[model samples]
Target chain A: MDMDMSKNMERVMKDKQEGLEEWSTIIKPKTSVWNLYIKEIWAYRDLLILFVKRDIITVYKQTVLGPIWFFVQPILTTLVYIFVFGGIAGISTGGIPKPLFYLSGIILWNYFADCFTLTSDTFIKNQNIFGKVYFPRLILPLSIVVSGLIKLAIQFTLFIAFYVYYYFQSGIAPNYSAILILPYLLLLMAGLGLGFGLIFSSLTTKYRDLKFLIVFGVQLFMYATPIIYPMSSIGVTAKEILFYNPLTHIIEAFKYGFIGEGEFNGLGLVYSGVVTFIVLTSGILLFNRTEKSFMDTV
Target chain B: MSKVVLKIENLSKRYRLGEVGSGTISHDLNRFWAKLRGKEDPLSQVGQVNDRTAESISDYVWALKDINFELREGEILGVIGKNGAGKSTLLKLISKITSPTTGSIKAKGRIASLLEVGTGMHPEMTARENIYLNGAILGMTKSEIKKKFDEIIEFAGVGLYVDTPVKRFSSGMRVRLGFAVAAFLEPEILIVDEVLAVGDIEFQKKAIGKMKDVSSNSGRTVLFVSHNMSSIKTLCDSGLVMSNGTVSFKGDIDSSIQYYLGNSKNLNSFKSYENLDEKPGSKDVDLLEYKLIDKEGEVIDSFNLYEEVSVQMKFHIKKLNGKIYPNIHVLDKYENYFLVDTIPENEIPKETGIFISTFKFPKYIFNTGEYSIGLAVTSFPGSIVHFFENPAIIFNVTEDDLSLRIGPSTGMLPGVTRMQLQTKTLKI
Candidate 1:
């Protein structure tokens, strides 16, 4: 053991004398859990942007309506809910216009859903490219988050158009002070969705049964949040269950700021922020671990 | 000597044999049990895999083990091996696509590997978009790609289709575009894995020239892996031979090729069939012994670049009616026949009982690579025949004298007329 240590010391000294200052890259079997390769991800930011562009452009490149489909999807979904849940089921919208209420909740929920589901399939969908090339593995999921953010912005603009249209008809004006919290709400959504997606993406590579469950999982997750219905009508006991859900606070706050119907608690927002931080950190940790050997199992 | 840029030490990788997810829970439990007791992987056997036996008592197999080598700046190292020789494993470890199971690889500069061209190119995207996207995926900054955008387009010859979608382009056009983007990468270290097998012959030559130009003109280091020996001989300055997950030989390009051919193809400079019934030829004439001999009458498989070697064959004829002569066929490593030697009709030997024939290949007449000879003892070409044996015996000629080699073998090897050393078959 002593001889081995002395030999290593001698080798290190010899390497220094040979002027081998530093290595730019070193690959090994077991790296630390916290070595998430953030520097590499930063260097590859351009690739992230390009991937987002490819998703946006290629999705509508062959469609007849092109970018118009982006608006049509939300509008169609809003009408379905108005018919099924509003007119037929006779559910109350807490005195807000049905179109404005459903549209706001739908747009924000779509952003979160897209972030979770798209990134969850990152490793499986990109096996070919990942096997052949070397880049930061986090770039693909990050790109999904960015592209979903852009889509959310567009749909939020549509939501605002409806807000003003209904403002003249029914006097449903947004709370300007509450609207300032919208950016913070979106950040929470991005972080939470990105975090859960990264964890599931790593897990699904090893256990493909999770892939089948995730689509319905996202759908069931939507109901657990305050997307289809208002939080005002729920009982205190039931509301407590929904309050514990981080997404519940985000969706409720987004609605309260938009049409002034749902409850907005500062404590709940802080709780959601803390949850987001925890999930995001763990997601990155799991993602870094899986990226090292996913090619073998994937 | 140049500074070393890439150093691999004690590199190894182990992989599970069967399905990854099937019954993995039990295996994980077993692994936990083993590790808690401080034991090696319970599912794997010890020792390296080899040509004879690879059957393991456990479910895991070591794909690579204890590999070590280094590459200096401006050196082009060609990695050659048969299937399942762990060549791809080594490349994956170096390129950072997959982490090694043990040991480490330290590199000085950016390493770009063209494992497969058009890796991330989407068909729905335009050619211009794909070029940008592909360049970025290969680790080029947007500004760097923009600076070389025109050069890339010109090299790919796709200026007219810049705005057109890539799906409309033919497969050949896509390959050209992909390679053009990578050729302008200007990375300090490059690793390529058989990507040259695609495209037309003309384009393949152009790609090889581009790689050579990069390594030579800019002092970049490259590790190229290919099954094509001619390409390896053409583009690489040094060579590494792999067999069954281990480095079999590492040396100059010529010796590595010789070593690989001799090892993988089971070629030898000598062969003898002492048994009467198990010979290679027909019953009428059977070969007894065949070998290569030097000036001291010593059997040798290898010689310096400028040295004389002789092919000596001994055979016995049980019955012979008409004229029979022994002919020799010499072929290079890629099996291109270099020469065919036979006696004139009048000078042919006949009525043979036991015969020995020897032919001389003069000094400086052959290039530095592996060569094999085919033997035939036959009657008249138009009529009856005795027998023919091909790939009879293989020998290697290597050159350590750098002054003798013109350049990396870019074109045809040296022919007989270039050195002008000729000799006829002798009855000894």
Candidate 2:
């Protein structure tokens, strides 16, 4: 009986040894920080697209207006800005039409705001799904970015309608530089939103106080940027303070390119680009670090 | 020899107790500084064992400690433990939903986990849309989901409500849809955690059948964690039993279950009621000892179908104005009562100081299985229970030569009792 038991044990041991030899994945407490594993994210692109679709389709499902709310939100916000900041507050738009000028800034700002808020709350909002399955965590934030872009596209058409009206009536032609720098401006805004959002999302897992702060902080941040008023209208001291804000250059450059009347400093744009790169790199590092263990705290 | 699909070595997870976000930054910084100075983490050494009921000495506790296991290809491993025994934590770690604080796990092929059903299903989305969404969340590609979409809907039996919003469906329907998507997930390694408990009996049976098909036919590895012993015994080839955040036993299914049930205090088959004061009973009558004895009058917990057994109960009655009958209720492991035998009031003695009553069961009366006995003393033809002790004793009945004569039975038998029938062949 003892010999038979030993033989059984030896056979089991041999099977285990053979099993170990064919192992394909090594899971550990920590993975190399430098190994971003972008290929894994690529493989999950279909899931990312589906998530984006779900967000876009379900956001206003119960509302009567449905997808029309996407158009109504930007239009209503633009009218309020036109009246409150342009007409009532008497904020100058650098000789540009109030509706067109504010609409342009509103569309871009809405996209960035949506991306930032959604991405920053990724860990908290999607903890249920994240805690139950294994996927590239980056897909969640990426889906938000993509959905935000789709919203921007819908809102951008409204801005173009206003731009065309003013362009023919008031002879306001978009400068060549604006068309050339449009892609760069969009990239910068996306980078800044995604980067800062990921950082806050990672931090919020440990410190829940950031959740409340992010909602109010995003509003306060909008006022700091030259979204309501043109950069050319501010005083020298105020301009210097606003210049330090990375978004100031993107908004100002956007107005200068499209409407042909806002401050567009080459150095300021370069500074914003560099800051976006830094924020994005650090955000990704922090996000990756937090994704592995966020469920423990969440 | 089969290939190894997953291997975990020295894996451990530590969690902060009490508060969610208390002093994590300081602890993180302190660990960083200690590591920089070439020392161990100051906090790692202070964590206590994971005992939810006890007062923790430190704010940190190890949820899972030094867990190690390996799975060969096509093997179904059943993980069983009491609540808070780190069963879910082990599944989470294997699923990559959470990482360990120390050690490593090496695995091959795609690993999909169903920690819960309807994980990413949106209430506003239609059943069809949720299928795609939930499928993607489980790591299935769009084409893969599209290929199995009809089958998933058919299996869930929600084809009539395909276009309706998920919120309109019943909870069972939602779970069926969610489970259908997960069931169709053809990952190389599948991890399931108590999800089979959802839905009705028919749905559960279907889901269990699907899981069996997935593992047996596809030659895939499956890790199942459940409190349901019957399902675990039916579906798993090997078993892993965890206790106090560590592995207690790992072996073939029968022995692992034996060790797990043996170690569990509440589920032990042999229970002696030595302390009469602790046993629940009225002051008039108290139970002293209750046990299952064989034909030889020896106390035993296990028996064969051919062996006659008796349930003996010793009691001390202070005063008895009326005749009291001794009753024993026999319930299966699933808490389904099979029989209730009560002694006649005339048979019981009216004047009793210390009395012993034994209820004998003839051979071949009970089928081979585990049974629990609840003891009670009550007045005959009256609805009053004077002294009652629920689940006072537990025992198991195994198949002997007499039972094997009927035929070989693999799973649970069809009826409650196995009776011998006499037959004669008539030649025309």
Candidate 3:
């Protein structure tokens, strides 16, 4: 053992002329804001995938229903919206069936809500692992985004079942061309949620008051979006104010595509896309600045 | 002359002592304004010079300060220190758990930290799933974990319950599984902080052996922080002693331990009370002098590892009410009582007298450490103590050259004593 160690040392000493850049990792006092470490994120994609798997498989472990809770949550929320907004409040669904109208909006809205609330808690919840190991800190919030997508996919099936039922019974037709934009709509929602979540998670590390504001804030923000009520049913002033909320356009487009009702515009989708890009970029910048030293405050 | 794989330069970490909340935002704003004006961070000046004796503690502390060290490939360096000596802080900085306030920790290849086992484990997940999950968290690819999956399970000795949820496993099994995942991490540099302090002894031995194997076979560097001196002494190639946020000593394993132990604040090795009124004793008995002497009757402040030394305590018994049992208590530096030797019954005094009670230690008795003696006189039954002086005099037992003679003094000699046991050995 001694001889082997000595030989290794001798070889290392002989290579002392190697430049400083030969070191694989160089931890410095400050990391520049521009270097987002996107490649490192790709390198640890396996961990990100496994994290998403953990969130999905272990969410309801030991419970009899398991992932059935995923479908139940959106189904229950859709029923409540149909009763309170469609039946009691006499809100117009733009002639679309109540279940189909509510299910589409609820599924899209739930995805954003879940992603925002959970991603916002990234730092505080995963400080244990973050403090112990060095992986792309971005993986945590990304996993939340991906897991949210998985849930949306499962709930999308339930929404499709309602859409198919309504279509066969009443011969209602969805704009197939508008439905093709679903993938892009899903991306916008994830971007908005992840962007907002990262900013909050980073801020909450130092000041935890933002943590308590999240659940309440997300609920209030949902009311501002065109989820329960159709964009055409509300007053023009109300619709104009709600349009400023980027989620309004995304959810409206989602409703238009599947139910062939609610508001949809190319310019509005473009505006939401730009807002998501800004929020996600700024969020990534804030997250990058925070991940390096958040453990101290956290 | 081995190539250094890890080099740290001027590494310093300043921590906010109290609530790092909105109250500090004002300070941060002040620092930001100063930095904008090409001035140094105002908060950075707080810990530059530690006024340890100041009347009030500062709101910021330097958890580590200007630490500089280098680790060669395949070198296992043990970091030992008292709590709050910046040992864990050093590990934290190296692992990038928290960024340094100022400095750089440059290293070759991947640096993996086992700061704690099962760091990201979800209790509801099964062992098989946790293996992949934890391995991935530790930076192993799925295919890599699958490749070493069987080896990890075999090493952990938990093959029977691979599919069982981790919550069902005992705490020991959980630790074992966690350690197993980390053991196969195979990073260029591994930072382990007291992970071995848990788990059973057999597993600890296995882990220790595995570390030695990993370093020697793969030429990987490992930085281990543990309070267990024996483990450090046995496993590390060199040692670093930390004290009060700085490197106090860096040398071979044995001398580093010596420096840490001898650094204990015990200025005087002999204590004597010349004035009768100020003696450390009860009214009946007063201690005159407490000191250590060798077999040649020469006074010495420190004892050699293989030297025959005696602790002699002289006291004046003004008045005796019952049989007095003069005893000497030997304690390690941390005040852990090792042994107490009382005078034989026949040697006990029955009346008032000026008596010198001596307790002798045979050669090669004490291991290397700082020790102190407690003098007391108690009655035999129920040990009624009349007068006692705890830690009356402090002395150190330091090591000498191996030529002094021994059976075999290898990497470490644990325990407070090195007593020689006699036995008859033939074919057996």
Interface RMSD of each: 1.0, 1.5, 1.2
Candidate 2, B1-428: lDDT as tens digits: 57778888998999877777667778888989999999987876444678788877777889899988889889999999889999999999988999898988888899999999989999999999999889988888999999999999999999999999999999999999999999999989999999999899899999999999989899889999999998899889999988778886787887677656655654344343332126546767777666677888656788887788898887777778577777899888788988999886467876868788889998888788878889887764555576677777777888755445556656667667776767777999
- Rank all candidate structures by their lDDT, best first, as comma-separated numbers: 1, 2, 3
Best of the two (1, 2) by TM-score = 1
Model 2 spans with C-alpha error above 4 angstroms: A1-22, B46-48, B266-428
Model 1 spans with C-alpha error above 4 angstroms: A1-16, B50-53, B268-428
Candidate 3 lDDT tens digits, A155-224: 8888778877888898786788998998999999999999999999889998899988998999888789
**Runs off by more than 4 Å, candidate 3:** A1-16, A19-21, B46-57, B264-428
lDDT per residue, candidate 1, B1-428, as tens digits?
57789999999888877788999889889989999999987776777473326476667777888999889999999999998889998999899888998999988899999999988999999999999999999999999999999999998889999999999999999999999999999888999999999999999999999999989999999999999999999999899888788886787888677667756655477655533236766667788767787888767888875778898888888777566778899998989989999767665556767777888887776777788889888765555556677887788887766566544664546553236434577899
**What are the DockQ scores of the candidates, in order?**
0.63, 0.57, 0.59
Clashes of each: 0, 3, 3
Each candidate structure's TM-score, on Cα atoms with residue i matched to residue i, is 0.78, 0.77, 0.77
RMSD of 3: 15.6
Positional deviation of A210 in candidate 2, in angstroms?
Answer: 1.4
Error of 3 at B298 (Å): 15
True contacts kept of 2: 0.87
What lDDT tens digits, residue by residue, belong to model 1 across residues A209-273? 99989999999988888888888877898899998899988888877777877889889999999
RMSD of each: 14.7, 15.5, 15.6
lDDT of 1 at B5: 90
Q: Cα deviation in Å at residue B125, candidate 2?
A: 1.0
Worst 10 residues of 1 chain B by lDDT: B414-423
